[model samples]
Target: MHVPDGFINAPVSVAAGVVAAGAVAVSLRGARKELDERAAPLAGLVAAFIFAVQMLNFPVAAGTSGHLLGGALAAILVGPYTGVLVIAVVLLMQGILFADGGLTALGVNITVMGVVTVVVAYALFRGLVLILPRTRRSVTVASFVAALVSVPASAAAFTLVYAIGGTTQVPLGKVLTAMVGVHTLIGIGEAAITMLTVGAVIAVRPDLVYGARGLTAPLKLRVNGELVDAAPARDFTPVAARSPKKVWIGGLVAALVLAGFVSFYASASPDGLEKVAADKGFDKNVEEHAAAGSPLADYGVEGIEAARLSGGLAGVIGVGATLAVGTGAFWLVRRRRTESAGAQV
Candidate 1:
C-alpha cells in the first residue's frame, strides 16, 4: 500500500527516511556481487515489470484491493540486495510521476514495502531452498511461500510504524488485527504471481535465475557400473546468455501490455492501506499530494478527456521511465564492480 502524507508525523517520517537511505546504501554495496553485465540490465527490466504488475490491483475482502509487492519475485529472480533497489526505484517513480504515493512519505513507503518485504522474503526463501530438493520446482515453491507471507509481514511492519507515529490515534490492537487480516488475502495473490513468474523464467533460463543457481545437480557418469560426479567442463558457455535480447524484449512487451491495457480493468477500489485507514478513521489526517497539479497526477494525463487514453498513456510513460532509470542505476553499480575487479587484478 502506498501511504499518503500526514499519516505519520514529521519526526517518524524523518526517522524512516534515514532508515530507507541506509538500506539503499547497503543494497548498493551488496548488489555489486549479485550483478554482472547480463544481470544488471535484467534487473532494470525486473523493476519496470514490477511497476506494471502493481497497477493490476485485485479485490480483497472489506472492499480493499491488493496488488503485487514484488519483493519476493525480484529477490528470487535477481538477488535480495538488488530487489530492495528495484522496489525503491518503483516507489520513487510512483511518488514523483503518478502521485500514487506521497513524496514526503516516500521513506515510509520504501521501508515498509521495499526493504522489509525483500529482507523477509529472501530470508525465508533461502531457508526453504536449503530444505527442499535442489530442483527448479523447489525454487518456485519457496518463492510462493515467501511471497505469500511477505504481505502480512509488511503489514505488521506498517502497523508498528503507525503505532509509533500515527497522527490519528487509531486503537493499536484494532489496527494490527485489521491490517494483518486483510493483507493475508493479498498475500495469496502475491504468492501466485511470484510462483508463476519465477517458474516461467526458470523454465526458459535457469542460469539467469539467481535463486536457481546450483539447482542443476552435478552431471553423473557411469564408471564401472557406478555413477560418479563428472569433471567440470572447461570453456563452457551458458546458452541463456546468448538470448538476452529475447528475454528483455519479451518482458518489456508483457509489461507494456499489462500496464497499457490491463490496468484499465484493475479493481477500482481503495487498496489495503487506504481501506484500513478509512475504516479505522486515521485517514482523516491524509493530505493532498503535492504533485496533484502535474499532468500525470493520479495516473492520468492532464487535459485528456478519455479515461482509457489518459491512463494508458500514463502507464506507458511510467513503464518507460522506470526501465530507463532502473537500468541506469544498476549499470552504474555493475560498472563499479568491474572497476573494483580490475583494480584487484
Candidate 2:
C-alpha cells in the first residue's frame, strides 16, 4: 500500500528516509552482481510491467481492493537486489509524477512495499525451491506461496512502523488485525499475479528467469549397473541466438496494453491500506500528495477531457518514463560491473 503524507510524523518519516537510502545504496552494490548484458534490459521491463500491473486494482472485499505489489514477481524474474531497485523506481515515479503515493511518504512506501516484500519473498522462495522438486511447477508453486506470505509480511512491517510513528492515536491490536486481515486477502491476488507471470516467463524463456536458473536437475544415464551424468549436448542454442529484444518488446507491449487500456476496467475501490485507515479513523491525518498538481496526477492527463483517453495517456507516459529510468539505471550498473572487472585485470 502507498502511504500518503502526514500519516507518519516527520521524525519517523525522516528516519525511514535514511533507512530507505541506505537500503538502496546496498541494493545498488548487490545488483552489480545480478545484472549483466543479458538481464539488464529485462530488469527495466520488469519495472515497467510492475508499474502497469499496479494500476489494475482488483476487488478484495466489498469496498476494498488490492493490486500486485510486484516484489515476488520481480524477484523471481530478476534477482532480489534488482527487484528492490525496480520497485523503488516505480514508487519514486508514482510519487513524483502520478501523485499516487506522497513524496514525503516515499521512504515508507519503498521500505514496506519494496525492501520488506522483496527480502521476505525471496528468502521464502529460495527455501521452498531448494526443498521442492527442481521443476517449473515447483518454481511456480514457490512463487505463489512466497508472494502470499510477502503481502502480510509487508502489512506487519507497516504496522510496526505505524506503531512507532502513527500521527493518530489508535489501538495497536485493532490496527494490526485490520491491516493483516485485509492484506491477507490482498495476498491472494498478489500470489495469483506473481504465479501466472512467473509461470509464463518460465514457460517461454526459462533461461531469463533469475529464480529458475540452476533449477534444472542434472541429466542421469543408466550405464551398466550405475547411473552416470549425461554428456552435454553438442548443438545447444547460444545466448546470442535467443535475443532478449523479442521478450523485451513483447513485455513492453503487454505493459502498455494493461496500463493504457485494461486499467480502465480496474476496480475503483480503496485499496487495503486506504480502507483500513478509513475504518480505523486514522485517515483524517493523511495529507495531500506533494505532486497533486502534476499533470498526470491520479493517472490522468491534464488537458484530456475523456476519462478513458486521459488515463490511457497517463498510463502510457508512466510506462515509458519508468522504462527509460529503469533501463538507464540498470545499464549504468552493468557498465560499472564491466569496468570493475576490467580493472581487476
TM-score, every prediction: 0.94, 0.95
Runs in model 2 lying further than 4 Å from the true structure: 217-234
Write one digit per residue (lDDT tens) for candidate 2, span 260-332.
Answer: 9999999999999999999999888889888899999999999999999999999999999999999999999
**Candidate closest to the true structure, highest TM-score:** 2
Give candidate 1 regions above 4 Å deviation.
217-236, 239-241
RMSD of 1: 3.1
For residue 1, give model 1's deviation from the true position in Å: 0.6
Error of 1 at 16 (Å): 0.2
Where does candidate 1 have its weakest 10-residue lDDT segment?
235-244
Native-vs-model 2 lDDT? 0.92
lDDT (10s digit) by residue, model 1, range 162-260: 999999977999999999999999999999999999988887777788888888755689999999999876746665456578788999999999999
Model 2 clash pairs? none
